[model samples]
Structures are given as C-alpha cells and as structure tokens.
Target: MSPLHLLQFFLCSVCIHMFSIFTYLVYYYDLFTSSHEAQEKYDFIIVGSGTAGSLIADRLLKETNYTFIVLEAGGKGHPFHDIPAFGPLLHRSVFDWHYETVPQENACFAMENSKCKQTQGKILGGSSKLNNMIHVRGNVSHYVDWFHGKYTKEYIEEHFNYIESNIYPLRNIQYDSQLSDAVLDAAKQLGFNELNHQNSLGFQKSLLTQNQGKRWTTSDNFDTSKYVLTNALVEKLIIKNNKCLGVQINYPKKVKLFAEKAVIISAGTFNSPKLLQLSGIGPAELLKSLNISVVKELPVGKNLQDHVGTGLDLVLFDTSQSVGMFDMMNFFNLYKYFVNGVGPLTTPGCEVVGFVSTKNETIPNIQFMVLPVGITADRGSHLRKSLGIADFVWDNYFSKLFEKYTTTFFPLILHPKSIGEVKIKSQDPNLPPLIDPKYLSHPEDLKTLVDGIKMLTKLLETDAMKTIGAHLNKNHFPGCEEYDLFSDLYLECYVKHLTLSSYHPIGTCSMGTDASQSVVDLTFAVFGIDNLYVVDGSVLPTLPSGNINAAIAMMANIFIENTINQFNLKTNQHMCSRNISFEELFLNVCPVR
Candidate 1:
C-alpha cells in the first residue's frame, strides 16, 4: 500500500473510534434524549417529578408491581443544582417556575409594586433543588395541632424516622469563623439552650440535607432509573364521572396519557391547584367564570398559607478577613470543592438556626437564621433580581449597604394568622397563577414579628456580638425615615417594609375531613373525586415551624404505606370471594370517621 493511503486509513479509523466513544458517553448519562413516549396505559400516572412525586414514584416502583410514569414540566436540573452553595443562583434559572404574587395591600412593600416573589422549582427534584438545604421537621406540637387528633405523635415520629434515612446532618468543619462563634455565644447569652439535634427547640448549628459537602436533593433519594418525561408540561387532567383517568401534556406536541388505576397530583403547591382548577375540579364559581364545566365544586385554591420573615443586616467593624459571595465564585475555591469537597463552596450560607416561642413556651412561633456574611447590594442584585425584587428595593434599602463586612439575622414567623389564595387568571395553563400571600394581614402577625425582632436586637447587644463589633445597619428606609433609629417604632416600620416570604407555601389544597373546608380528605384523596390524590406541599393543612421539605417526604411515606395496606386488603379479599369489587372495598376501608 502507498504511504498516503496508509495515513488516510489511520486518520479515518481514529475518527470512527472517537465518534463511537462519544455516543457511548451520551447514552451512559441518559442525556440528549427526546420526551419519553407513554404506553397505552399505566397503573399510576404521577404528575410533577418533585419532592413528593419523585419519592412516590420510587416507592411505587420498588415496593409494588404497578407501572408508573412521572411527568415533569422542566428538564433535569442544572449541573450546579447538586452543589450546596449554588442554591440561591438556581432561582429564575430555567429550573424555577418564577411565580410572583399579585399586588399586596399588607406586605411585600420592598418588592416590585408590593408583589412578593413566589419561587417554585420546575425541575425533576422540585423546590428541593433550590432550597437552602436546612433539614428541619418543625416542632411536633405544630403537627399535632394540624392533624387534630387524626394522627398520633407516634405515627408522625415513625414516618419522620423512615424519611430520615435520606438526610445527613451538617458536619463540623475545622475552620471556624469569628462571626459564627459570636452568633453562638450571643444565643447562649440570650438564655437560649443549644438544640442537641434537629426538630428540637432553641438555637444550634443547622442540620443540612447534604451528604459530605454536596446537596442531597429528593432526586438523590429516589431511583432515577424509573421512566420520567422531562420538559413535558401537564396542561389538564382527563376526568370523567368524578374520576381522574389521565393527563394531557403539552410537550410542544400535545399528547394524552391514560392511567388505569389512579392519578396523583404531586405538582407542588402552586401548580397543583392550578392544574385542578383547569380540569374543572375547583370552585364552581371560578370554573363557570372561565367557561369550564365544573366536575366537582370544591375549594381547590383557597386557604394558602406561607411563612413570612424580616431580616436585619449588621455591619462588622473589622474587615481584615471575611467570606462573601465572590469568594465562593473563586476558581481556587471551586477547585477545592471539586477536588476535596471542602471550602466555602460547600457552605449552605445560613450556618446557624434557632427556634423560639414568642407567645407560648410549648410551641415555637419563630425561627432564626444567622448568615456569617452580609448580603450587599451587588450580591442582592444578583440574587434578588432573579427573585423578582424591584429596583426600588435594591436602590432604597439594599444599595446603601454595599461592600461591607457584615452578618445578617433573619427572624422567620413560623405560623401566621393571615391567609392567602391562588387563582387562575385565564384558562391557559401556560400562564402563571395569581398568588396572593397577603402577608401580615392580621394585626397580631406583625406584632409577633416585631417581638421576634426585639429578641434579635437583644442578641446583637450581647457581649459576644460586641466583641465581633456587630452593629445594626441604620440606613434610612424610604417609608420609615420619620421614625427614630433603633427605636421600637422604627424597627416595626423596618419589618413592615422589608418582610419577605420564607418560600414555604402550603395548605392551598388543604386536607381535612369535611369536603367544604378542604380540597383533599385525610387520606390525600381529592374531595368528591375518585382515583385522584394530592401528596405535595399543597395538601399540608398547616405550615410547619421550619422548612417543609422533611414534612413533604414524611407525608409521601405515609401515603405509600396507606396505599400498600389498602391494596393488600383488597387483593386478599378478592382471593377469598370474587364478588367483592375494588371500589366497594376502598370505600369500606377508607371512611371520614
């Protein structure tokens, strides 16, 4: 053979080999795939591959013989979503739904036109991918009150324990910041006891939902091998005779999926209610207004509740050394994280958390979060802009405090007397929902927050805080400039102007025994509907004291157990007598009483 011919042959061989290797890599990661086409029918159709939906799919696939599919509105999460510190950056990315509240009369004064930002994760892991990774189950008393004797404390604890397998507490690090130490000492000086573990009262280091230095989202807990259709937006439910059969999805091309056994709506709080209303399962008046034929006249979008909180930024006199947002973005720090899984890149930002009771000693009404580094206007602009904060808030409140060594204290109101609602503006499922949190609507809600702020102020005055030279930023707020700085009235005005949502929206499709009061029954089945259930944050009858991720997981576990037990009973009875129907058995097994 000629030398030229031999060179060409060798080059062609190398190109073919490289192409084959690239193809293998693409298939290995399950990347570059089109929407998964559904079978003619599945045993279960779960909408939204979120915190609850993903876990539900895992349980059903692993513990039963049922065939199921998860329909997700967004694609697989971004690469940074698995990192602990990139949580804030995930907001407004393709991963977030980026829903905003309607203009409010009572709160969100600092945001754009009194509208608070309502962020929900649109990716496979849902909001768990975007949350701060604080793994808190909230106080047990709050759960007892919400359940109202329906669920015993023992039952709740059991479910929590089962879900705890996925969680790993934040481990102690060798490098300690002066800011963190000062905050802990201040908590002690204020007569707060250190909590030994999560779900307990008093102040302590936060227990994160992370393994090592990486985030452990719901996506990590579940089996990803199960079939899931990403970027497939579910438009409406296919319902007939008060029974949910399947879902209609819009994946740039319309497709309908049928479920033979049941349909579960685990589309988080905002989208779940919206989907129900679109399917003519909401309030009769709302459906009629939208020209939708009402299938069930139930309040599907009422009783929306969320945790609201206000924060205070404190400037430290010493600027010799401190961590800031830029520090995490440093190439060296990123290298450290990628190589050794340590450094600022592993931090969840909010290091310490405290639970305090403002009204009753038995139940915690407020949760305190301490961040070692202060958030300045530049950082706020980067983060809050994506969160939908207005230019007015950035200029008036945040911009003045740029480039300062500081620490921030967030006093979160656990339970608010005020309630909100979610409503659909148009019949189009593509448009966002009208979210109205109506934060601080009740007079007492604001009063309770003020009391909590006072407690924070006292903590700042402690000797430990003084040692770190911590002092409140006295920047003049636009609406509260008339009040004297550091006074009670001034602080009250500050809180009213600067309050923000803790991002824990719940109870929109609340669960209760009565059909009139809630959208779902205690068993998580939608009221007045058959073969339909909701097992997401929307069905939480009340807001927990802390982050609601753990609670959502626990509810999914309980639902799985209840479903399996019911299925087993029906199967056993059918073996004994062929005369018994599944519907009759379900009704007999599950009664409101």
Candidate 2:
C-alpha cells in the first residue's frame, strides 16, 4: 500500500472510533436523562413500544382524547440506529433481543450447535431498528386474503396511503453502482419488467424506509415521549374475571398499571405470543403444565411463518465492479455521506431487488435481493458473527473471499409453506421464548428454495452478468461436499447448511374470524378475551408476498382507526348527564346512581 492510502485508512479509523464514542455517550445520556414515572391507570396500556405499538400510541395521542402509556422493554435509540449501512452491526448488540432457535429437526444444519440465531430489536423501534429497511408493500391479493375480501382494494390502499404519508414515505436509493445496473440488466435479459410498489413480480430498485440517507423507524413517528416508559418490561397482563384490565410491569420493581379500556400487545411475532402465554392465555395444556390459571384457551403462538432465504456470493474478477470495505470507508465516501447525506453508507447493503416465480410466472414465489458487498467483505469481523456463521465454515469456505470484489444475492422464499410455533418454557417473561421456525420442514418449502437457487443461477448465466465477469463462488460449503458442486443435491445441502432468515417472522398470533384457528379477530381483539388485542406482525394470518413491514404498518393503521371509532362509539353509548370522558363517566355514573 502507498503512504497516501495508509494515511486515508488511518483517518477513516479515527473518524469511526470517534463516532463510536459519541454514540456511546448519547446512549448513556439518554439512559440517565429519561424519566420513567408510571401513572396509577390509563385509558389504554400498550405493551411493547415496537412498530405497531409506537404507531398506535402516537395515533391515539394525536387523534383521540384517550389516555395511554407505552411500555418498552428496551432503552432509547442511538446515533448508529440512524445510519442505513450500519444495520447489520446492530445485530446482537444491546438493542437486539438476541434470540436463538432450538436445534431443529429438519433445518439450520450448519449454524452454531444447529441453532439459528434470530435477531429482533429490543429497542423502541423493534425489528425495524435492525432490518434492511426494504419497503415492499406486498401484493394486493395478500391483503385481500388477510381481510377475507371484507376490505376492498381501495380501502386497503387508503390505509396504506395514510401510513405512507404520516409515518415514512417510500423512497429509492439516490445512487446505483455498476453492479446494480448489471443486476437490473440481467433481470431484463430474463424478460422481467419493472415492478411498482403494489405489484409483486419483476425487477426494481428496492423501496426503503428511509429519508435523506437515514433510516426512518416507527419510533420516529412518536411525539408523545412523556407517555412512553422505556426499560419497562410487561411481566404479564392484570386480567380479572376474563376481562382484560391492565399490565404488571417489572422495571426492577413490580408496578401494577390499570387500563380502563384495553391492554394492547404489539410485541412483535415472538414476544407477543410469549407475553400471552406467560399471562396464561395460550394453549390450556401448556398453561396447565406451567401451573398457571388459564385466562383463555387459544392458539397464541402457532402458525409461525418467515421469508427464509439462502445467499450465494459471486466473486467478480474485476474489483471495481463490486464494493468492499475500502470503497465504503474512504474519505470521499465519508464526506459524501456526512455532509451531503448521500453515498454507499446510505444503503442497507441491498441495492437491487427482483421478484421471480419458480412455479408460476404471474405470482412470484422467490424474491432476488442483491447486495453490493459480500458477507465475507468484512473479513470474519462483524457480518459472519451477526449471522452466527460457524468458525470452521468461515475459515474453510468464506475466508478465501475476504477483500475480494463480490456481490451477494439472496433468493428468498416469498411464501413459505412450513409453519412453526413459539411457546413459553417456564412462564418466565424475562427468559426468551422457545422459537421453532421449522424452516423447510414442509417438503414444498425445500423444493421452492431449490428452485429459487436455480433461478439465481440462471440470472448469473445472462450476458449482463458475463459483462461484469460475475461467477458463482465455487468453494464448497463445509458440510455439502458429499454432492457434486452446482448440482441439485449440493445446492439443497448448501441451503440447509447456510439457511439465513430474511428476518421477517410473522403469524404467531394470527387473526381470523374463527377462534379455533386464530388468536385475534378481524378487529385485532383476542378471541374469547375482551379488551385484549394484538396489533403487530404476530397478528398476520399469513406471510405477505414481499417484505412484511409495509403490510404491518397498513394493518396497524386500520386497527387504530377501527379501535378509535369503537372507543368513541362506546363513549357516546354510555353518555351520562354530566359532561365527562368515558373513564369519568364509568366511575361517576354507574347504575344511574
């Protein structure tokens, strides 16, 4: 290396270290400065100030006169959370819930101890804080199926519009590199057209949950900071006579908080069900086994689904065609990012995304997400550890590709057939739930993934890819050497060994009209349990065709409007002679006394 290049590296190192110190200072500052005073009661008590919880609370505070409190298990946000490129680094950090699945029967073969590491944000924004920020509205048909056609396309689109306008508008990245262009061209070569946000198929630059090169999380929509109590974990619901009351929070000291109207659980997929189970609202047998009095017998943690994908890295012969650490950390890129808020650092790694169908061309089954930087680009540093890649696999397979110009393509199974469940182990709210995603357990799911791999291989054979000199990294995966390289058996083995979650887990606390098959009703209220609702990804009855975040926001928005209208209707129905709110009306004029 030249002296000037060495000097540039040193300067970049200093800037990163200084920024790290600043972020730490900011974290500590918020930790000490924030207030955590709990009121005796509220009109509504929201547990888990994640994506849905934050949006619901904010909307309630802004649109209605209802009194509510948001309880978040995690602490305040950091500066690092704002940077798009710094997303992967946030995994397994203080912000993440840091969950790991139990050793699986049919999948996660090559992960540490055969356990797949699940990353969920424990921070205010929840998983949105740790995701790639890909903003896919998903296919309209999926929404139709979710609401069972009761909600029209226009109604759903209106809600989506409301959310997009109020929370975070969808936007594409400012710049596209040569690799991005190549990916797009290759998709065109395969006869794929450009797809808009509403459409499900074709190639397009991914819409992101960002503004001006910064990540826009659900927490950013919250203006009612005083009502939000961070670091306050909801141990269980304070239920009485099968009617929901409030919550019992544990922030080192047990504090009982009453909710006059309802208690909403928006604690993502895993925690929402886990919280329900802990409060004796899950399967009767599980509650009986745990010796807890059952509040309601419902399948609180079944029907778990996620968009699982396996990555294939392509090593480029020409180094300039792909991005590496040096390209991202240089003085020029830093200047462009910090001062102008535009550069590679603005990307969450995925630059181009395409949707393709393995079985049906019209309905896409596989989503192709391309990242400019390779997983091994960081040289066994953060990315490998974040994914929980085994040390042996890294040393043997990925270590050779360090600093090599590469692009990683992930072909995600858009609609997985395999269903899993989340269950409570010992009725402990602090202990992580037993998450069994059961990825690829269904024969169809494995077949779909294999077909996705085949599609990706086909994309590589396009003339566009050849121009960039992109070739599949042929190094045999440690455990998949028994089969011939590039063969179907070898690819399947590679997929099983190197399965990576798209981090979009949903449907644990599913919603439907039938109580036998669902936890929450169409209104998001828990079946057989009044005044208790779930409004997170947990309530999704099935996985959406694309990224799940946009659909979640739309669902929560509908819930908020419906709930507000319901609350208002109740207030009007119970009107008394004295002019007062619903809570006061209930307390003062009971039985016309």
Candidate 3:
C-alpha cells in the first residue's frame, strides 16, 4: 500500500479501536464517572420521557416550589397517544425506540412472530404512548410479594400506597366494546372468571388505562398547567463529585444543558439499563471488554428478566368483515374518537386482559391480551430486511408486520424465573442497546405458553371467533404444524417461531434486599452508589403481575416522591435558617386569567 493510504487506514483503525476501548471500560466498571462539566443547579432532573419518567416529573410538579428538568431521549408524544386504536400505528414512528433483540437460537434465525423485534416509546408518554391500553391490575398477592420481597427495607408498604394515590382515579368509564365483551363471553363459556382489576390490585376485568376513552399518560396525570414539551432528546447523564448532579442533554437544536439537583435514570427497561451501562455502570467483566473504565462496579445491566409472550393468530378469509387500518370507516371513527372521545378509536389494540394458571392455582402465571384487529404492516421491519430500518425506528418488528385483521390475543409468561441483560453494541449512544431479552429461556416459560396457547385456541373455538372464521397462520417454518399439540419438539419449534416479548421488560437493574439477585434497594437507589437512582422498569426485582406501563409509572412516581421529599426537607430546613421568603414562589407562578 502507498504511504498515504497506509496512514489513512491506520488512523481509521485507531479511531475504531479507541472508541471500542472507551465503551468497554465504561460498561464493565465505573467509579470515576459523573456528568462532564456540569455545575448548573436545579431541584431535580429526570432522564427519559416514557411512562415512568413522565409520571415522576408530573407528580414532582405537585411541589411547585421545586425547579425540575426533564431529559427525554425521544421527542414528545402526539394527540394520537390519546387514541387507543392508533397503538400499532405508533410503532416505528418517531415516538418509538424501535429496538430489536439479539438473535436467539431457539427462535428462527430470521425474524418470526415469536422472535420479532419489538418497540419501546421514545416520546413523552414513554411506552404508554405506544402500548396497548389494556388495564389489568396485577393480583394483590404480587404487591404483598413486592412488600415482602424487601421486608427489611424502611416502610415499603407506605411507598406502595403513596404510589396508588397517583395512579388510579375513581372516575373512569365502563363501556363494553365488541373486543372485551367477546373475550369475557368466551372466558365465561369456558368457565373462566372475568373481574375488574386494573388498579395494580386485582385482575378480573380488562381495565382501561383511558381517561374517558382517551388514553391516560403521565402528561394527562400531571402538567396541570404547563404544556408538555415536544421533541426533547437527551444524550448523556451529567455526573460530578461522585454524585449524579444532572444530565448533559442535547436537543435537536444541539444546545447542551447542565441540569442541577440529581439526574434520575428512568429510561425504562430497555433504555434505562442500556444508558446506565453506557454511562459506565455494569459488570466488571463485560465493561473490560468494551474499554470503559469502571466508575462503579454495581452491576448496571445484569439480572434482565423480560416478560415474554406468544399468540395464536387467526385470519378471516373475508376482508369484507376483517377490520384493517385501510378501512375508511376506521379513519372517520378514529377522528371522531379524537374529538368526542367515543368510537373504536378509543381502544388500543389488545383491549382485553386475562390472568390465568396453566396448573390449577388461584394465582396467575400467564397474562392474556385480546385485540380486535390483526397486526399491521411494519415499514420499519420491511425496510430493515428488504432495505434497512434506521436504528431509531427499528426495534418493534412484530407490530410492524401485516395490516390488521389481527383478532389476536397475546399472553405473557408472568412469573418466569429467567433473566437477561443489556450490553453496548458500540460506544455510540445513538446506536441502540445490544438487547438480549433471552425470552422463554427457561423450560417452564414454554410450558406457561403451552397452557396459554391451549387456552387461546379454546377462546378462538368459541362462537365469537369461529363465527368470524378464525384460522391460524400455520405456515411459518418447516415443521410448525406437526407440533400444534404439546410435544417437546413442537413446543420448542413453536416457541421459537411464535415467541415474542410483551414489550414489558423488567429487572435489569433489579431491586432487592439480596445483592445476588438485585441491583438496588427498595428505595430505588442503585446499590453502592450514594446518589444514583433507577426510576423505571429496570428496577423491579421481578416481573410485575400485570401490564407494566401503569406499574412502571407507580414505581417511578414513588421513587421521585421519596427523593424529592428528602431533597425538599433538606432545602426547607436550610431556608428556615436563612429566612428566605416563600414569596419567591408567588412571584414565580404563571399569571392566571
């Protein structure tokens, strides 16, 4: 090679190697890590704008005396977030993280329904903006388990109750839709009970995450006066003096801000754990491979237990009766929903939720969600395979498939003992996390689905489904049809072909009294860190009993409340000595008409 060409090649190699080394060090260990050049001040700064972060920000706003900063990696959610029918439409849009999991062996080498890529929200509402709004509260036993999980912690039950006050309100509607009623009818025909349990307390009826048929998000719950900002993007957490001061966030404008107070990481299950490892907080061994220095060896991205789900898809031959996105009637109804808050547009896909036991038990090990429409065509996944999906919009593959004639019900493996982890694909935060959901990695997880599938097949056999001519998509792999029953070979192949994430990833940065299984205390504080806290799905010690959106919001709200309370008490006590007037608050209030 010529000398000049050689020099160019060497420099490029050096750049790649340097970046690789920097990422590895950050991933494995971190103690010297903090915000870069952050000296600005505020009361609280939260990272991520998803379900949990938004709730935390909004609830903290109840304390108007405090100055808060919200750092979102994705942009703001749209009015579409209020429309439940548009849930699938939101996937691969700007609001979604659009992540794909690392390829699995049991599942197809290529993307199948079970192993299809999934999405998380990047907008203000987080995943709640993108998720189906089925409101099934977990069984009460789960919370009792949550409370009992950290019995040694200080006042855990108090945290749970405080979280409740911020989540479920008394005033919601009970309108019966064609979707939910059908499932309840089917379940009852088979002698399964359907009750009301959307409050994170019980699970008998399909609860609504809607406020009067409009979607309920963190923005709806809080921001009583302020307009929730649009298109905010966060780049990095700003740390200083061995404490999390705030974040160094860059917007589309490219202007960087240094938030004061504490930078709370609530980036949800996928992003939160990934961000922590990116910011240099993960396993020592993995971090060493990436060349990132160990700032805190507190296990930033281990113990990843994701709630995996699978489904039986039935397609009606007659497009005449089959509901799809292209149906002009749907468009008008959707528009009407935005205006009057009535019509099919108000319901997100999977409007019905059920908790069931594969083995006979009062407690549920699986969660079933029913949708009226078929899945949609994902331009993102199409482009990713035939073309290419941009990293930002490529995560959710299954939802992006085919236009809806879906009439599908998905069930989550609720109590799986398996776990997974998040690693850096590269040092670039712009690139997605190297996600390893390790879905259905455990043997019992497959059995849970086997039971769930048998249950769903029965539901489809009902007059509601069969009258509609429900038929399975039996042509995925080579031998999928032969094992339609519960043979080990069939179960493995079927699971590989049909297994997919419910998109509710939890426990990456788990919370527990046992350091062996957890990454934090019950207080949501990262273990071994003085000021760092995790306020998203990543901190849950185990998978929650029901839909993760509301539960995540509850966890985030409680974590923020505790932190702000402590911060406020400290400031209030400090103010008392200085004799500063509360009049500053009155002056700061936005003038009302």
Leading candidate by lDDT: 2
- Please give the lDDT score at residue 153 for candidate 2: 85
| Model number with the top TM-score | 2
| Local accuracy of candidate 1 as per-residue lDDT tens digits, 1-593 | 24643453455445434533543454334445664666768989999887788888877877888888998887775455677766765676656787888988877777778787877887778888878777777766667666667889888988887777643344543233567677888888978788753435678776777766887766665556457888788999999888888999986678888997789999989999999999998889888999999999888889999988887464444562356655766789889888887888777777888888876585788888887765551345345665455677666766555445666688888888999889898899999999988888898888888888878778889999888777777777768889998577887777777777778999989988888898988789998788899999999888887889888888888887898778766666555444656685676743322
Comparing 2 with 3 on TM-score, the higher-scoring candidate is 2
Q: Report the lDDT tens digits of candidate 3 across residue range 407-458.
A: 5667778878666788776667788887776776677777777777776777
lDDT of 1 at 512: 85
Candidate 3: list runs displaced more than 4 Å: 1-39, 108-115, 147-179, 197-205, 222-232, 252-260, 315-335, 376-406, 460-488, 514-517, 572-593
Write down the worst ten-residue block by lDDT for model 1: 167-176
- In angstroms, the error of model 3 at 362 is 1.5
| Candidate rank order under lDDT | 2, 1, 3
lDDT of 2 by residue, 344-417 (tens): 88887788888999976688989888887777555555667777888888778876664456677888988889
> Can you give the lDDT of residue 225 in candidate 3?
25
Residue pairs with clashing backbones, model 2: none
The true-versus-predicted C-alpha distance at residue 404 of model 3, in Å, is 12
Evaluate model 3: give its lDDT.
Answer: 0.60
Report clashes for each candidate as comma-separated counts: 0, 0, 54
